[model samples]
Target: MELQLGVLGVGHLSTAILQGVFEHGVLDPGSVLLADRDPDRLEDFAGLGCPVVPSTELVRAPRILCAVRPQDFPAAAAELAPLGSEHLVISVMAGLGSDSIRSSLGGACRVVRTMPNAGAVLGCSMTAVARGPGATDDDDAFVERLFGAIGLTVEIDERMLSAATAVSGSGPGWVYLLASAMHDAAVAVGFDSQLADTKVRQTILAAARTLETSGQPFDQLIEGIASKGGTTEAGLRVMRENGFVEAVVAGITAARDRGDALGAADQ
Candidate 1:
């Protein structure tokens, strides 16, 4: 069968995307083509029956997913510059814009820029997508449906993509850091390592489920758990005193700024 989808890189995020697509029946494995510089990585995907092709051949597919690293984009774009206007190019590369991609690829192909978190590995990613100038409504829907198989997707203005990158693309690391802290605290309190890990994981999961289902304001959810003079409230008071909220805001801002810097370099 002819390849319908082409992936430009075979890194962790690319593997997650392929896994989600295959596991969820989004596309047939045989119809997917993969290209990467590393033969080992290509072999890994080849073992799963995906055809390994040269990067130069990626343009043959009607839909192409660019998962290459920011530093590697110039080379990949050179390979894809020959793609015709019929190609729909979707890029998951952080800090790179659709405009940059379009310019690099001869300004002809339809392009979409997306930020999908590590949750894609578990089919729970929070993805934000923005279309380039050449993209049409059909292109938008096609990209959205392709990503929707892996997780929730939101459409946003390209201008806000950096902020989305900070919040959604970089957000998983923040959550994981909090989980690690909670687990460490549990262990310090004399809990066994296994119990600490399980408790912290379940606590985070339950809290996330509640937030998802409650439809309440975040403050309201917090108030529900941290009543005045309660243990939760006491802990929150310490966190507030220690500027936890400020720290989190600063971290997000830094990530956004870094994204802008990366985009600037590409421009």
Candidate 2:
């Protein structure tokens, strides 16, 4: 909680991240070093008991977190080169890897490449991480802690970052896709829109909470709600017969491939 942290952007993820850091006891607000090009927005860091500096000044902190957009990567990473080998570069930019970041920072800063979804704002995100070859176990552990400050953390080979992107990173989009379909289907079935919205929302949330808290087997729990010869069972039968899971899996595969294409382009 006492370690130095420099947050290098003032965007949504950065702001939500800053808030999560405060709410989840990741670091004392006073210990955070913040920077952004927009001085007006950077002032938000003030109430958190932080020091707001010009972007270049943030390079002084040993644990530098780059939450800027992919387009800003080069300039931002360049500014931190002076910090050199001492700083661990943890980045949240998609389509850019640790090697590119380390390369931009003069090849000595240890890099941690991570992908976190928008749910990070809600403290329920799943973060995927991979380390630069030079990174030590302690560096990886620190990267884990940094993301754990918000939600779940999983480490994998850097090669799988695209798979991680296709899943958790772009997962919220997939979840939203299903939710939207469900919502529209409910309204199509002669239900009031508001009623349909509330039912879908509560049902999804209830089922998720049950999954998290219940010690029962998922099939048993699901079967309990979907009895023999009931509406839910009939719907489940239709979904299974129509290959609902197969379609979802296909979408994820496509997403993963696209991410791979993007990475390959950078080479």
Candidate 3:
């Protein structure tokens, strides 16, 4: 069978996307081609029946998923300079815009940029997709289907991608930081380390599920748990006093700024 998807760069995020789609039966190995600078990575995927082709051969597939690092795109782009409007370039690289991607690939291909969070490993990522110049509605739908295999996807303007990067893309890292602190706090309060870990993890899982399924707003949900002058309120008061919300907003803004800088550097 002819190859349907050509995957460039088999790094952690790309690997997770591939695994999610493969395991969910959204795509099969026979129709997917893999390429990476790392021989070991290519060899690993090759064992799963995906042919490891050079970047130059990626043109054989109409749809190419480019997951190379932001710093590595120039070289990868050079190798795919032969691509034209017939190709659909789906890029998941952080900080790189669709315009930049198209220009780097000789400005003759359709591009779709996406930001998928680390939860992709668990097939629960929140992915943001932005259509680039020359991409059609069909292209966007195709992209949504691909990323949707790994997680929920939202379509936003290309200009808002930097903000999306800070939120959905880096949001998991922020949650991880909060989870670590909660685990530490539990340990400090006399819980054993193993038990603390278990408690923190399960709490996060349940809380996330509730946040997704509950129709109530965040404040309402918090109010449901934290009665007036209760233990939960007491703890929340301390967090508020410590400027937790402000700190999180500031951190996300800083991350967005960094993403902008990375995009500027590429341009």
What is every candidate's alpha-carbon RMSD to the true fold?
2.4, 2.0, 2.1
Q: Using Cα atoms with residue i matched to residue i, what is each candidate's TM-score against the true structure?
A: 0.88, 0.92, 0.91
For model 2, the superposed segments whose C-alpha errors exceed 4 Å read 1-3, 215-218
Clashing pairs in 3: none
Residue range with the least summed lDDT across 10 consecutive positions in model 2: 77-86
lDDT of 1 by residue, 191-250 (tens): 999999999999999998997789999999999888889999999999899999999999
- The numbered model that scores best in TM-score is 2
Q: Write the per-residue lDDT of candidate 2 for residues 15-58, one digit (tens) a residue.
A: 87778777778678788888888877777678767888877887
RMSD (CA, Å), candidate 3 to true, equals 2.1
Predict model 3's lDDT versus the native: 0.89
Candidate 1: where are CA atoms >4 Å away? 43-49, 183-198
Name the runs in model 3 displaced over 4 angstroms: 43-48, 187-195
Report the error of model 1 at residue 245, Å.
1.8
Candidate 2: residue pairs that collide: none
Q: Write the per-residue lDDT of candidate 3 for residues 1-267, one digit (tens) a residue.
A: 877799999989888988878787777888898888888877756887898888889889989999988879899989989688999999998888788889988889999999998878888899999999899999998888788888899999988999998998889899999999999999999999999999999999999999989999999999999999899999999999999999999999999999888888867
Clashing pairs in 1: none
Local distance difference test values of all predictions, in order: 0.88, 0.83, 0.89
Best by lDDT: 3
